[model samples]
Target: MTCFLIPTVFQAGSLSLIMGCTPNASHSPVFLLRGFSGASVSSSLLFLLFLAVYLMTVVGNMTLVLLISRDPRLHTPMYYLLRGLSVIDMGLSTVILPQLLAHLVSNSPAISASRCLAQFFFFYAFGVTDTLVVSVMAVDRYVAICDPLHYHSVMSRQVCARLLAMSWSVSVVHTMLHVGLLLPLNWAGDAEGNVNLPHFFCDHRPLLRASCSDIHSNELAIFMEGGFLMLGPCTLIVLSYVRIGATIARLPSAAGRRRAVSTCGSHLTMVGFFYGTIIWVYFQPPSQNSQDQDMVAAVMYTAITPLANPLVYSLRNKDVKRALRRLIGCGAVDS
Candidate 1:
């Protein structure tokens, strides 16, 4: 509890500092290519890799968004959640890709302190937003499968809109709370700025470690925000799935039950991967010190999963597949 409690105060103060209020930069050395242990990487290879992933993530998510929007068949609560997820994927990737590309190509790959904070701000913002969006999806599915008659009214258009709005608002408040407090910590000036992040983007723990001053505020903010953000939505997802499972279990026919389970299973897999990697990365102590391990987790959430969302939700889904076939009007979509 103390671990969770302390960070809340730090986040509160940090948020106060980030409202166009500049803090003096600490003397953290700008490492252009530190090593795999730190975020150091060769300009050419990293940029190429980032470019490929960026294209895939954008194209995949955008395609899903388009398919859902254009098709009348997809005008349901579940597809709406997928659409929200696609938008978040687009946003989260865009927020990080440009700066990452700049850092990889430029000889002096350095982000200004303020810009770094801004990157972390939106990174966490949209990431949290995506998590909540998926949680909403779980609830939608639960209602749809568990209580069919009420599903229409319960997850109606207005209700869906409000949920999406609330999710975005909550994400903004939480991200701003942590990132804003993070801006004030003196990083460059202090000698403790040796911590290097492995990934391309600026993230909370990595940026916090780069601070050269007292990290009491930084550590506290990390613990509180990380705990609340990860736990809150995760709990909601679990609860929704549990009820959904119970409902599926009650299906009269075995085939019906199997179909219901399969439909929900893809979404559940996505939820687990997204939440699992993110929680492990942010919540665990760094002493696990697995740079390789950490990078893998980062790739799962940031790169791989975004690419997989369309495939995971749309490809396997009967409704989506049918809509896509109608939209493309081809013999069949490429395997």
Candidate 2:
């Protein structure tokens, strides 16, 4: 293996030399991304479709945030958490989609190592925020349904703010831990020397696959830490829902039960969609055939989910629909 030392500057104002194992090859500080190579669709069409979806995701999430903020009726704990979820969805899509759009248009789809690291950091942070926010929403729902009398006292404005703060803090720390583990590893390739990543985004698994470094410890840490980040919230959500189900079942009137179920229906749908895709992407065993599946799954959680969330909440939620109508009517009157 011929080693070439290439000096590069990270965003942190530090200069480091990266070692490449390819013989007589040009030393490029950029990492080439293999984005949706197996797609039968043309890149131009794909780009346009995704661009539309991204626009919709941003606009929809922003509208949801505004609706929650403007409407006094939605000033409850549930809507507060939903607004946070919208923020996270918007952030997650923004971080991933612009880079993806650039890659789709460019003939050479590559990113600098520093840029890749930054993307990875923001992507994971937003994703963890999404998960934690959803989990918090579940708990909020549980408190509202299971302990209705004390819900206000338990999830007060101050308490809700603190919970949101805690979720963001945990997300930042979780992303930092992953990025810290990834930073020290070398990206030298194998004997045949392929360094291009298979996925569009700078995900941990694909980056690890491209590296020639010993990732045993890294993998272990990912399994433990990543599992906690993924499963812990999911378990909480499931438990909360189960308790909610029991409470709903115990309700005296069928109308009351229906109301309770409807209250959580939108959130349940989102959690199912988000975690279902996420679980398939991360937990499934890696295989040659599964590459396309993984990419599709990643797209679902990153792009499709964000776009769908506002639609789900807005359509299923009568309060939100009424609030939207009132807001639009007020705007029209002003105009």
Candidate 3:
């Protein structure tokens, strides 16, 4: 992988002048991304493994999207939101995996500054989209389980559309702030004149850590805005599930309780899986051992979680299975 560096003395001098820090003289247009180092596994093998996972992630999420669209049975608000989630999953994986794979094969793996910013923008956009969509899905489950009679009225097609739009808008604005703030800053390299990004992808933390500029404001934005964006949706999701659990407990029939639990099981699993890794990665205090930990957590949320979402939903959901079978049957009949 490619990496870049700036001297601390140069950084200090540039910081003194601020706008006087010339990009052409101090910074290379390309930044080196140090991918997994000291790996027991070979790069070729790593490449193959990541490639297979990427393909599976794309195909699985795309299949989920198509299945939800074509199947009339899945035309409900829940599935509509699910289709949106599937699209986000596909986008998230596509944003990182292709460039990552390309870097893995290259003798000199590096990305231009412009490309890095674009990658950072889309990565966080989809990530925030995932959080909001999950929160919305939790709300959908709460209505369906706790307030069944009002479900159709509350979660109308128009409402679903609005919610989806709102999710995208929020994500766009949040990422815009992040990228907007990052654009003007000067990044200084380490003592060796290199900016070393420990993790695989272009994450916010590594970039922040590597910068020579005064990052107090940037750090503040990450803590304040980033915290709310992540924590708010998580709080809503938790509250919705808590209410769902109470409602399930009050059901008169055992079968009713079973049905309610079954309806929410897939979503709960996904929420746990996605949020658990994220919290572990971002919320924890950084340490000497944190680099490897961060890389592993990054892989989980970016690659593994997206791949597993479709599996969890499809395998647990009989409706999706039936739809898939019917689709295959129709295709076979046409042949």
Q: Which candidate model has the greater TM-score, 2 or 3?
A: 3
Kindly list the per-residue Cα lDDT of model 1 for residues 238-300, writing each as its tens digit: 898889888887889999998888868778877766665555554565466544544555566
Model 2: lowest-lDDT 10 consecutive positions:
1-10
For residues 138-187, write the lDDT of model 3, one tens digit per residue. Answer: 99999999889999999998999999999999989988998988887666
Give the number of the best model, judged by TM-score. 3
Model 3 collision count = 10
Question: What does the lDDT come to for candidate 2?
Answer: 0.77
Give, for candidate 1, the lowest lDDT window spanning 10 residues. 1-10
**Candidate 3: lDDT of 221?**
70
Candidate 1 error regions (>4 Å): 1-43, 189-199, 276-292, 330-335
Show model 3 residue runs off by greater than 4 Å: 1-28, 189-194, 280-288, 332-335
lDDT of 2 by residue, 297-330 (tens): 6788789988989999988889889888988988
Q: What CA root-mean-square deviation does each model show from the true structure?
A: 6.1, 7.8, 6.0
State the displacement of the C-alpha of residue 74, model 1, in Å, after optimal TM-score superposition.
0.5
Candidate 1 TM-score over all chains jointly: 0.81
**Backbone atom clashes (below 3 Å) for every candidate:** 11, 0, 10
